[model samples]
Target: MNQLQNQVSPYLLQHKDNPVHWLPWGNEALDLAIRLDKPIILSIGYAACHWCHVMEHESFENQQVADLMNEHFVCIKVDREERPDIDHIYMDALHQMGVSGGWPLNVFLMPDQKPFYGGTYFPKSNWLQLLNSIQSAFQNHKDELQQSADGFAANLEDKSIGLYPVELNELTPIIPEVLAKISKYLDPIFGGIQKAPKFPLPSLTLFIESFPEKLDTNFDVYIHSERQLEKMAQGGIYDQVGGGFSRYSVDSEWFCPHFEKMLYDNAQLVYVYSKAFQRTSNPLFEEVVNSTIHFLNRELRDSSGLYFASLDADSEGIEGQFYVWEFEELNSIIPYEKHAPFYQAFQIKRNGNWEENKNILFKNHSVLNVVYEKELQTLATVRAKRIRPQTDTKLLLAWNAMLGSGLVQASKGLNNHKFLENAIALEESMIGFWDIKNNLLLHQISYSNQPIYAFLDDYGSYGLFLIHLYNETAKVIYLEKLRKIVNGVYQNHDQMNYLFSFQSNLNAALISNKYEITDSVIPASNSMLCELFFWSGILLNDVTYTLRAKDMLAAVLEQAAANPLYHANWLRVYSEWMENPQALVKYNPSNYAKNELPQLRVTWVPIVDQSHAFLLCIGDRCLSPCESIDELLNQYNSI
Candidate 1:
């Protein structure tokens, strides 16, 4: 019987009726592997992964392949979104085997749960051969395989902290040097790195925006960052008719995306674009922000104010089916008069701008003013009639918190209090998922049931969001909530070498207490923890928090300097640390004007002090309170 029938994860459910008897990852499956004396086929993938669906259709659903798999292995299906801990463990194991990591990651693990061999996405023919070969190896050379697994298991101990040794960071001006190194990879003509299959890693642009007041010896990082943002805003990766961005482009030109829309990516991109708008007053940035927010509201949001995980990359058994458009489809929808400009602007080709004789809408950055606003709405109205991509209904706390954080930041950029209000509403909803006394957080908000515990990223991200809220609202309650989360991370998580832990659960997995030191598509949980500690330390007036936060950044500074793209989040924190971020204790709610200052140095610590004065503080030290906002601004500018 397929044990996955009971699972809430869409990915697991996708395989529930498969000919292979797939069990959700649990002790039952592991014990079955041991009892049957069989190797474990641990398949990990997320709901929205196009290849995951492909593999399911090609192999798992094939009765012949299923017979081979069922006879040899106790197959365990894990939705990476539902069980990131298990995913991280096996994915790391795959990496330790010197394989580049991706989904759907298929690993052959021992009954003891240590991964011996792994590879991603195999054809049915290869998979069949692999199953027989692996089964033969297990029967004949069990001892040798165990030893190899042991070696890989030992190397898994080198998770983040052990792999990247904690150095005695100089706390000197490393930003200039790091920026110089990063400048080498920046695709100046287009926005992102000079590599194909580009991701809109907001961290890179965000880091460029984090230049201190004094780091102006050379390099206009803003221009390069702006160019990238503008390119993305005008690219196919960003949905032109609809709102929100796809996962990433499959090309350097941002012409074709992988087309999975993750809540985290959209959330992070919104925050990045808002900052861009704040700095440059670019209407495109504002429009993108507004449109993306609308996308989130209309599609992703549950009436409860939390969001769903992602939109699947595949629709109707075809990737990009929902998002891409045919040439004639555009011709029929657009008016005859506007067809020329619309086709010219969107670069729609009769043979398709993308695969399958369809166009992925995008405009050349030079011709962004070629108007098609009314035509886009018409297209959206028509496109709305097609079958939509499946939404992964799992409402992750980390993702929701990120969107909340983005909304707060957006409120600043758009000069609209509505964003902040929306953020507050989201908090009201998400706060229900937390068990503050036990330091317990549900992995995702669910209308029915939430069986998973929140991971380290969830805690760190929620804490970071609370920090943003506290600053924006001057609500001491947000800081108090942040303190609880910080305490939870400190007490609940087992430390990895000298750095922070990767997840909230201590006993969930078999091996590796990893530290997420570098940034990926989303900022690492530890980087968020660093921010959490930095602010909680500053605002809460705790020296322990400050020192711990500083140590976290210290551990990654050298590595972060070496490769800033993967460590851009850490670089942002390091840059802020070097600047000695000052907190301004304002007696009123922080408006957009105060927060959006160019090269702003002070962090807002809002309080309803009876005397409407501004208190400037650095670490624990504070200057005399200023009499007025003007005086504070003047004083801050001079300093």
Candidate 2:
């Protein structure tokens, strides 16, 4: 075993047995690179990446390849989940080189840790040839390589100099143009954007939810949203027997998936489905929400009441082995009477839809029409006997907070108190991460038992969830915590207006700090921070917080206006900013009946206080306080 054997990350532990002498990314690796006069080979991947596994098996495990790597380089393995700060810097470097980046990121860095060259995955022959070439170039043309490295490092530094505040322009007209651009990419047949490998970009789904009127009237957004949700519900991307979605579909039809389930994806998806149900009152959306919640509760949640990071895509050395099934195996497990309905509903065929005569169960029919629950149970029972995929047990604060927020949204939309109870419990559990003395929120908790200082996402996402909890329970404590955390975010940043991806002091080894503007698989941390600041400003009556949010929004508005799909989260913030009239519902607990609290269809700022009345407010203006819930609803509707 190498240095990885002692590491806490499951991804690094996976490489412990490989023939390659791997070192975890740290001072030891850097020192070795300098002392031995070798370029550092930095490989970044997570436990759930399929291509990561493929490259590991092809190159890292081979003896000859290992010998070459050990001789020529200080090979460092970085689990991207564990140290996203490192991954972000190198991935940015790849983009600077005009290379499209993906997982299994391989970058060659100088001893001083400046990245010079990188690419994603490579075949064994190609990888071997590339290694020799890099080695030869490093030995023969040291001056040229150093010049290239210096230039790349300079570019990264230039990009890191903070965003400047632009004047806020009318974003209302740009909304229609953004929607028109989004409409051009929509697959009229399949639902999502017209792309081959379809990902459930929750940001897009969220944009649909927030801008219902704009999309529904002009773009048929409601119809398209339903189609997309239905396609995912019936597709193999969503586990038919089990109860969650995979990372994405490898095909445009959502027929075949990469088959890794991530907490962040499911959490945001639950919020999306819940909102869809709220809009349409569709039973299908409700079903998806409930099933997804069940999956999270059963598989991801630990005894600590926090959710795990993700489940691996492979099981027992074969990708999708645990999830996929042979037609004959299904035929034997399912009873005769149930066979035909199950087969017809799930598109089971003799030829098989996937590789090695295996079928990834799916239904092309309407999700509402499908009724094969009993058959699914039988299949699930049999599949349980097989090896299950490994779960990455690390608890990330941002992801857990996301799940908590989703549960709260689901609870409100579906009127299911159980989901609300779960969200509250998760909030209570996460309180341990709060450092009252230092005013810090730890990013993650792992087996190592060390406190990883929080990143921007940790503060933004968890802070947003705290706001949700405050709305649900009317608890002042949640609001107080939200304010404190948001304050910490500002304190950690050099500029008070915008947030950086990592805390300023954390990840000091990184070449530059990154500002996440575009939404990725998860919404940008900065966007979430902006929303938190905006809401906190209103709830606390703080002008500074409000102005900071507006400044950050103004800086990103031009970028968002140009390509709204990528900046969906930013657009959501802009939407709320433009439509500044927010309803503030103030209610007294003693006067109003517990069941009489208004069920909100539109977003509102709910406050619980000692006053025995309800006050409706739009911005700073307020209507006279009313005694009855019905009176409050009536006044709100009139506006």
Candidate 3:
């Protein structure tokens, strides 16, 4: 057994019995590399990555390749989900070396842990050649390799300030430009980033929701946003039989998805779909929301209600084996009377709609245009009997928070109070991750029951989600969590202007501390913090937090205008700010009708002071207190 045999990360455990001498990323591995004076093989990936599995089988599991690796390098295996900060740093180093980044990220670093060279997955022969070459280069060309490592190391800070922003552009002017810039990239017909291997980027939908300034008759932003959601819901990327979404579609038209299901992707998608349902009253979006929630609850969630990280892309050693179906299987599953239309709606070809005689269930038409829930459910039952994909059971703080906040939105949008209860309960369960005795919140709770130090996202994202919950429930518990998280973030704030480093006080500096500015699959920690502080300010009636939020947003806004896709979350907060949203507060908790308040229209910040009426205010700008919930809604609607 290798060092990974004792690790809690499922990704690490998967490779535990491999022939390669795999060491989980830590000081032990680093110290070993230095002692042996060997270049470190830093292989970073997660459990759900299909390519990672392929590489493991082809190279790490092969005795010959493992022998060469053991002879030449100290191989450190890092589960990216467990140490995203480490992944972020090394990936940035790879990018700096003029390499496009993906996982299984195999980077060769000097004994000092400076990355000199790297690439994605390599076949056994190529992996052997690379290992032998890197070793030879290390012995013969030590100075040059160290030089390359130094150059890459110097450039790995993420220049996050410049990349993300310090927001200088006025909200009014940039709002139109941000919309126009993002609109140019929209696949008008397909809906999402205009590219193949398309991800369900929540930023695009959330940005549209934030600022819906239509370009022209040729392009309506709202319709384009809805089309993307509808197309995704109707496509294979979404599990037609099951209720969750896969990581991404491998095609331009949302068909044939890369099958891993991520907690973050599904969580963000729920929030976006729920918001769309509120805006358009689209039942299809509502259906997607409810089903995805059901899927997460059933599959991704633990018995404790905390969601696991992701479901692997493969089952029984074949990609999409668990999700895809043979054409005949579909034919036999559908009712005899409904066979023809079900086949037509799902694009089920006799041979296959996709690879190797297997069909990924899909519809060419919009979800709203078709009704096939009955047929899909039948397929789901049959699919359940197949060997399931291995689940990565790492519970991440930000991810749970993302889903919890989405549920809060869905409950308000769909008026499902049961969803609300679950959201609250999920957060309540997360209390275990918080160390009340030490006042240290953790990013993950391991199998050994040790608490890992919180990252900025763990602090910021969960804090932001808690703030959202407080808005919905007016509960003190969420706010109390927010207080701990806010202090943790501030403790780690250091001196990086308005931005916070990705590492918390407990997280040691890697080669460098990553400051997330650009929003990717999830909002950057700084961006979420901007929103967190803004809402926290309103909720606590603290002016300092409001200023901190404004400062951070202003800085990010400067860099966001040029590339809105990268900084969509920043712009979303800025747009929400422009709306001058009032905190519809009531002095009496009994006066606040949970369902009566229009959630999307008004940002609720509950304060049960001694006042008699509902007070609505945008910072200092205040509307007269209203006597009834009806009166408050009337005043809110007028705005």
- Model 1 residue 589 CA deviation (Å) reads 6.1
Clashing pairs in 1: none
Regions more than 4 Å wrong, model 3: 158-172, 212-219, 335-338, 367-370, 447-450, 579-587, 596-600, 610-612, 627-639
Task: List model 1 lDDT by residue over 234-320, tens digit each.
Answer: 898889888899999999988888999999999999999998888789888888899999899999999777888999998899999
Q: lDDT for model 1, on a 0 to 1 scale? A: 0.81
List TM-scores for all candidates, in order: 0.94, 0.95, 0.95
Which segments of candidate 1 are over 4 A away from where they belong?
A: 159-170, 335-338, 366-370, 435-439, 446-450, 579-601, 608-612, 618-621
Clashing pairs in 3: 165-555, 166-554, 166-555, 167-554, 167-555, 167-556, 167-557, 167-558
- Put down candidate 2 lDDT per residue, 496-611, tens digits, no spaces: 33555454564444777677777878888888988888888867768798888878888787778778778888887776566433456666655654466667644545566536
Task: Please give the RMSD to the true structure for each candidate, in Å.
Answer: 2.8, 2.3, 2.5
Rank the candidate models, highest TM-score first: 2, 3, 1
lDDT, candidate 3, 1-639, per-residue tens: 367777899999999999889987777889999999999999999999999999999999999988888888999999899988889999888888788989999999999989999999999889889888999999999999999899888888655474454434334556666777887898988889899889888976887864444333424668778889999999999988888899998898889899999999999999999988887898889988999999999998898779999999999999999988787776677754566887887788889988798888888876542376677677777878999999999999889999999999999788888988989999888976876788678789774334568888887779878877887787887777787778788875553767888876575557887788889888888998888887777677688988888878766677777788988888888776644333445445666566555554455667765376577766447788888778877876787
| lDDT on C-alpha atoms for all candidate structures | 0.81, 0.82, 0.82
lDDT of 1 at 442: 73
